[model samples]
Target chain A: MLAKRIIPCLDIKNGRTVKGINFENIRDAGDPIELASFYASQGADELVFLDIIATFENRKTLANLVKKVAHEINIPFIVGGGISSIEDVSILLNAGADKISINSYAVRNPIQIEKLAGFFGSQCIVVAIDTKYIDDDWFVYLNGGRIRLPLKAFDWAKQAESAGAGEILLTSMNHDGTKKGFAMDITMQLSKNLSIPVIASGGGGCMKDFLDVFEKAEADAALAASIFHYKEIEIPALKKYLNENNVETRL
Target chain B: MKVVIIKYNSGNVCSLANALERLGIRPILSDEPDELISADKVIFPGVGEAGNAMKYLKEKGLHLIIPELKQDVLGICLGMQLMCAHSEEGNTDCLNIFPLYVKKFVINKEDKYKIPHVGWNNIVLNNEVNSKLYLNTENNKYVYFVHSYYVEKGIFTSSETTYIIPFSASLKKDNFYAVQYHPEKSGKTGETILRNFINL
Candidate 1:
């Protein structure tokens, strides 16, 4: 059986790993490459480096940082943030990233997903959806989950899957960093509807949180920041816990 | 030495090249037959539909040269599937080097095990002494895999994995060796597997 994935997302700014509460008030965590290699050694299935700093200077540094991390780690690394064109995907992929993730740009111009998927197979392109709950329904958010859109979370995921996206990363702004648990309602609905793999992001605080998301939400993978970043939860330990919980993991 | 990666309208060339470079080996991307035949090792990788991949290989005339080569040859994911006797993806014919046929996973319907088994899974060695890919790893050590169809468990299977069905995860015959998993994406275990292949 295919093992469920445990992913640790790193928000990068000027070659350093940073974290924030709901995409604001960025605080430095550690060096980007060092933390990435550490996560790989700790048995993370994949790593996602989001270039939160979208400035030109930071973009160049993020590119260099991607090269540094790819040089050391042996797992799949996904690069996102400010990836506006195919050329950007090429540069990051050539620099050693196995896949390139797109968010704001992908929602604005949906054809970019098809174009990227056509050039580089759908497996190499990941479409991330940041969502916030509103009036009993979930709405898609762009620009780091600040601007909520009219399109619902499930609809966007269906559209993205139909557009040939290999995987969809769905993050809940309402539960992000709250340590309550995953957005099981949305994740369960999306996983049931979308044929493609769905990665549950945000609101994981412990091993039970991972188990809850996998069993209840039916997520293919779980992404976390604070729990992994602050050393509250380690990947190998979590995998071990999930294994004990009867979830198939690569342990 | 510049390694010429045979380009036959397939993905995974860049990742293979990157994996090689990690091992201090620089490879070249080439679809030209002469370039491929002259390289140190020929790596054929695919990530799309299986039958169409074989059609592209046959059209390029690389199919004939692939089996006759005395040099090392490796296939990754769909690349490995194309090396078998036949595939059920498009119900197309394959090279038949390993004498195996790829088949679709039959669903129980009552259960929800669907096609395209994606993500990391185990590698259980079928032949302990002859297995090169599973060397240095413990029995049932896991590796990354992504595919809808798999080579049915048979005499040619080197390593096997069990999900909805027990299937061949790696196959080996003389110099022709291939894995249904992506070593480039799998962590240390996959890196060591690729390293063993490059060294072999």
Candidate 2:
């Protein structure tokens, strides 16, 4: 059986980690490479680097940072935020990113997904869906959850899959940064409906939350940013907790 | 030792190069037949459609040269699939090095297995005498895999893993080694396997 993945997401701004990852060993938490290496040492299954403010010039810097992180870590690395075109994906993949996740651009131009999947096999294309529950239905949001679209979350997930997306990174806007728990109902729905792997992101507070998402939500992977960034939950200990709970996490 | 990674228009070559660099080996990425034949070890790494990749290989005449090389050759992911006799992906004909057919993974409605089995999965070694790929490694150690098509277990299968069914995780024959999983992305256990390959 494939082991459940524990991912540590780092928010990057201007080529540096934005959140101050409070780890005793890490002298500079703002350094992306330092935090990435720390996570790798702690047995993180994968890492996601989200460029919060991905300007044109900042994208170049993020590429360089990605190259550095790729050299420093051996695990799978995913880069997201402001990936708009094939050239952007090419630059990052050539710079050594294992996968590239797209959100707003994909929502606007769904055909780009199939084109990207054709150019760079579907294995590396991850479609990140930012959704918020509203009006008795889950709606997809764009531009970092500041704008809401008329598209339904579940419908968009299915469309992305058919558009050749290999995986879906589902983030619940309500649960994001709340540290409450993953969006179990929607995550479970997406995972069951899609044949591709679903990565449940947003709202991971405790180790039990990881287990709950995996066991109840049936998420193939659980992604958390602040909890891991702030050192609220250590990855190794969390994996240990999941393993003990029969979640089959990588230890 | 001179290590040469067969260069094709495939993905993940950079990552594989970085991985070799991590092991303190500067590998040459080349498709030149002479360079491949002269290298101490050759690695055929790929991540693309088999038909497209095969077209590129044939265009470079690598299709004719890869099978004839006498030195140790390692094929990864799509490289492994291409080393087989045939593949269901894109209906492409492979190098026939392993004399096996690569089939697409099909999950039944009742089964929960996902296609493109992308995650860390354990391998069950076939206990072959020449199988040094798992040297100093314990059983059930997880390795990273990302593929939609897989080669069925055969005489050359060195290790097996099951997603929906048992499939060749690693295949080995005279002077050729292939793994469906990405050792470069599998962390420590994967590094150990790559290190063992270098030592071999």
Candidate 3:
């Protein structure tokens, strides 16, 4: 059986790990590579490092950090935030990043999804959609959930799938820092509609939230930041709890 | 001991080198048949399309050199798929070292299983098989995998994993070994498997 994945997303700013509050006010968490190694050692199914600082000066820092992470951590880790073209992806993958996730660039130029998928199989390309509920519909947001687009979340996700994105990292902006739970209704609908894996992000609080996301929403993976980073919810304990609840977590 | 990683245009086989480096073994990444043939162990690692990988392997004549090498050769992910008879992906013919057909996972609307099984999944080691690849590795240990197609369980299957259907997670035929999962990225369980392969 394919186990439901528990991912610890480390938002990176200048090679350091930071956790954002609803994608805005951020504070330092730790070193990205050390946190990545800790998560991998603690039985994290996978790790995602979003380079929140996508500046020209930070590109080399991100790449150099990726090489160090690849050298140390044995588990698969994804690098995202500022990836736009094939050349950018080539540099990261060659540095030993397992997969690369894209958001703002992908939404602006959707055709790049197909081109990246064509060049480096769809399995390596992940499209991250930041969504917020407004006016009775979930709207897609870019620039770390600051800029909202006119696109509907569900429709855009379907389009991304058709364009050859291997996975969808759906983050609910409204429930991001609430620490209540994931937006189960939208997540369930998208999970049923898309053939690719949907990683429910942004609103996980406790072990039950993860259980709810997997058992109720049927998301293939669940990603959270502060909850795991701050030691509020330990990964091994969470997985053990999820497994005892019959959620099929890898323990 | 010369450990050569059979390199082609596959995506991110350098991760394999880093994994071996953690085990204190530096591997030679090369496409030369002479290097692959003379190495004590060869790792055929890949993460890309079957047809494209096979095309590159054949163009470099590695398709011919790999099977003839008498040393132990291990294949990972697409490398394992290319060792099979055929793949539904791009309708490409593989090296046929395992004689099993590789087919894409059909998206069953009723099951709703994801197309690419992209996570950590456990594998049940076949106790009957004498492959030392899982020597220190425990049965039902989780390993990372990211592929849409799978090789059917056959006489050469050394370990099995069930998703939508039962399939060979690892296969062995004399001097050749292949695993559909990424031991290089499978954390400690994967480290054990890689160590076992290196010690072989």
Error of 3 at A127 (Å): 0.5
Model 1: per-residue Cα lDDT at residue B159: 87
Compare the candidates by lDDT and give the number of the best one.
3
Candidates by TM-score, descending order: 3, 2, 1
Greater lDDT among 2 and 3 belongs to 3
Q: Clash number for every model? A: 2, 0, 0
CAPRI quality level assigned to candidate 3 from its DockQ score: high
Candidate 2 at B107: error in angstroms? 1.5
Model 3 segments more than 4 A misplaced: none
**By DockQ, is 1 or 2 better?**
2
The top-ranked prediction according to DockQ is: 3
Residue-wise lDDT of candidate 2 within A12-131, one digit each (tens)? 887777642221122223688999989988899999998878899999999999999999888999999999899999999999999999999999999999999999999999999999
DockQ of 3: 0.87
**What tens-digit string does per-residue lDDT give for candidate 1 at B122-197?**
8878864376766677777778776778888777688889878898888888887888888877787888888787
10 residues in a row with least lDDT, candidate 2 chain B: B124-133
* DockQ of predicted model 2: 0.83
- Rank candidates, DockQ, best first: 3, 2, 1
| Clash pairs for candidate 2 | none
